[model samples]
Target: MSRISIIGTGNMARALGSRAVAGGNAVEVIGRDASKAEALARTIGGATAGTIGAAPAGDIVILAVPYAHAVPLVRQFGDALSGKVIVDITNPFNHDLTGLVTPEGGSAAQEIAKSAPAGAHVVKAFNTVFGHVLAACTPEDPRPLDVFIAGDDAGAKAHVSSFVESLTLRPLDVGDLTSARWLEGTSVLLMRAMSGKAVRSSSFSIGLTVRD
Candidate 1:
C-alpha cells in the first residue's frame, strides 16, 4: 500500500480518501479547516487529518483543491514536495466553473510542472470524474470507471496508473504533460453535460471501445 496525502477537505478529497483507505493505504486529508479534515479522516476509517503544511510526506501527493487554489498551495509546498509523485487533480475552470481558464498554449498541469520543485514528478489525473461518482462507484460494476493520466515522468505515471487500477478503474495513458490541457478541457465538457442532464447517472463514464 502506498502512502498518500490529499490536499483538500471538499467532496473530492473525502471521496479519494475513502477509496485510498479502502485500498489499505495510509491516507491523510489536509485542509485549512481542522474539524472538517478530521471528520473526513474519521469517516474514511484508516485515514488521518492535518493541516496542509503538517501533512506527512507521502509517496504520492494529490492536490484536490480548486484550480484557483492549486498554484498558491503548490508554491507553499515548494521544496518540501521534491522527489515525490505529485498528482494534479484540479481542472482549471473559471470562477463560474462553467468554462476553461487555463491557457491554450499550456495546461494547469504544465504550469504546475514549471512551478513545482525540480525533483517533483507531476502527473495529471482524477480530474475527469465527478466527486459523487468517485464516492459511489464500485470496481465490481460491469462498466468500471476510467481515469486518464498524463505526465512527463514515465515512472511516476506508471505508479499512479497502478494506484488507479487498484481502485478498479481503467487507466488510460494519454501521453505526456502536454496532454493535460486536453484532459482538463474534457472535464469542462463533462461538467456541462452533467448540468444539461445528458449524463444524469453517476455510473456513466467517458470511454471508447474498439472492434477489429
Candidate 2:
C-alpha cells in the first residue's frame, strides 16, 4: 500500500479515495474547497483532507480533476510536486463529444507532463472507466478490471501498478508515455459507446482477456 493524494473532491475522488482506504493506503483528498475536501475525506473514512495549493503529503498524487484544469493545476502545484508520481485520469473530450480537445498528436497526459515540474513523473491511467464503475470494483469482486498504464518512467509505472493491484485489479502496461494518446483516444471511444452510439448498454468497463 502507498500514500495517495487525490486532487479533487468530486465523484472520482470519493470513489478512488474509498478504494484506497480499503486497500490500506493512506488517502488524502485535496480540493479548492477546504470544507468539501474535509467532508469527502470523512465520507471515505481513514483519510485526510488538504487544500489545493498546499504541498501534497503523499508520494503518489492522482489528478482527479477535469482535462481543462489538469495542466493549469499542475502548473499551480509547481515545484511542490517534484519527485512525485502524478497520475492523470482525465479524458480530454470535445464539448460535443465528437472528438478530443488536445492538440493534434498530443494527449491530455502529455500536456500535463509538459506542465509538471522537474523530478515529477506523469502517468496516464483511470480514464478508460467511469467513476461509478470504478467504485463498484473491489478485491472481493469476481470480475476483473483492467487498468492500462502508460508512462515514460519504468519505476513510476511500477509504482502506479502497485496501487492498482491494491484494489485487486489488473494493470496492463501498454507502453511508454507516447501511448498515452491512444489511451485518451480509448476514452473517447468509451464515451461514444456509453452514449448509445456504439453500445446499447451502460453497465460495462473495458476489460482485457488473455488465454494460453
Candidate 3:
C-alpha cells in the first residue's frame, strides 16, 4: 500500500480515490474546486481533499486531470515530485474525445515526463477504461482489465504494476515512455469500440493461460 495523491476530482479521480482507500492506502484528492474535492474525499472515506497547489506529498501521484491540464501541472509540481512515481491517467482526447490533441511523436504522458522533476518517473495507465468499470471492479470477476503502462524507469513501472494488481487489474507493459504514443492511440480505438456505433458497453479484458 502506498500513499497516493490524485490531482483531479472528476469521475475518474473519484473512482481511483475510492479504489485506493478501499485498498487501504492513504489517499488525497486535489482539484481546482476545493469544495468538490472535499465532497469526493468524504464520499471515498479515509481521504483528504484540497486544492491542487496545496496537495500533500505522497509515494505516488496520479494525474487524473485532462490531457490539456497535465503538462502545466507537472511543471508546477516541479522538484516537489522528484523521487516519486507518477501515474498518468489522462487521455489526450479533445472535446469530442474522438481523437488526440498531441502530435505523432508526442504524447500526454511524454509531455508530463519532460516537465517532471529529475528522478520522477511518469507511467501511462488507466486511460483506456471507463470510470464506471473501475468503480465497479471486483475480484469475483477476477478478469483483469487491460491497463497499458509505459515508463523509462523499470522500478517505477514495477511499482505501478503492483498498484494495478492491488485493484485487481492487469498491467500490460507497453515498453518505454516512447510507447505512450501508441498506448494513447489504443485508447482512441477503445473509445470507438465502446461507442454505441459498434458495440455498446464493449470493453477489453486481459487473460493468462498456462499449458502444462
Candidate 4:
C-alpha cells in the first residue's frame, strides 16, 4: 500500500485522504492548523495527523493546497522532502480564470520542481477531475475516473500511477513533466465548460476509452 501525506485541510485534502484510507493505504493529514488536521484525520479514519513543517511520514507527498501557495510551501519544506515523490495537484489559474498565472510553457509542477531538492520527484496529477466525485467512498460510475500524470522521473510516475490504480482510478501518462502545462489548460477548459452547464462532478468527468 502507498504511504501518502497530503498537505492541506481543504476539500481536495479531505477527498484524497479519505480515499487513501478507504483504499487501505496509510495516510497522514498535515495542515498549518494542527487541530484542523487532527479533525480531518479523525474524519477520514485510519489517518495520522501532523502539523505543517514537520518531517512527513510518507514517501509520497500530495500538495493539495492552492496553486498560489504551492511554491512557497514546497520551499518551506525544502530538503525535508528529499527523496520523496511529490504529486502536484494544482492548477495555476488566474483570479479571473481567463488565463493561467504561470508563464506560457511553464507549469506549477515545473516551478515546484525548481524549489524541490534534487532527489525529490515532482509529478503533475489529478488536476483534471473534480474533488467531490473523487471523494466518494465507492464510485457509482461504471467507468473509472481518468487521472492524467506527467513527470520527468519514470519511477516517480510509475509510483503515482500505482497509487491512482490502488484508489480505483485510471492513470494515463501523457508525457514528461512539460505536458503538465497542457493538463492545466485542459482543467481550465473543462472548468469553463462546466460554468455554463452548471454541471456537477458526478455528471461531468474526464474519461478514457480504448478501441479494440
In terms of lDDT, the best-performing candidate is 2
Question: Sorted by lDDT, highest first, which candidate order results?
Answer: 2, 4, 1, 3
Model 3 clash pairs are none
Off by over 4 Å in 1: 95-98, 200-203
- Can you write out model 2's per-residue Cα lDDT over 1-212, one digit (the tens) per residue? 89999999889889889988988899999998899999999999899998788899999999999988899999998999999999999999997778889999989999999999999999998888788888877678887688999999999999999999887788899999889999988887888787865776665789787789
The TM-score, computed over Cα atoms with residue i paired to residue i, of candidate 4 is: 0.95
Candidates 1 and 2, the one with greater lDDT: 2
User: What TM-score, computed on C-alpha atoms, does each candidate reach?
Assistant: 0.93, 0.97, 0.90, 0.95
Query: lDDT for every model?
Result: 0.84, 0.90, 0.82, 0.89
Runs off by more than 4 Å, candidate 4 = 137-140, 198-202
For candidate 1, give the lDDT of residue 73: 86
- Worst lDDT run of 10 residues, candidate 2, spans 195-204
Q: Can you tell me which runs of candidate 3 are displaced by over 4 Å?
A: 95-98, 202-212
So what's the TM-score on candidate 2? 0.97
Give candidate 2's root-mean-square deviation (CA, Å): 1.1
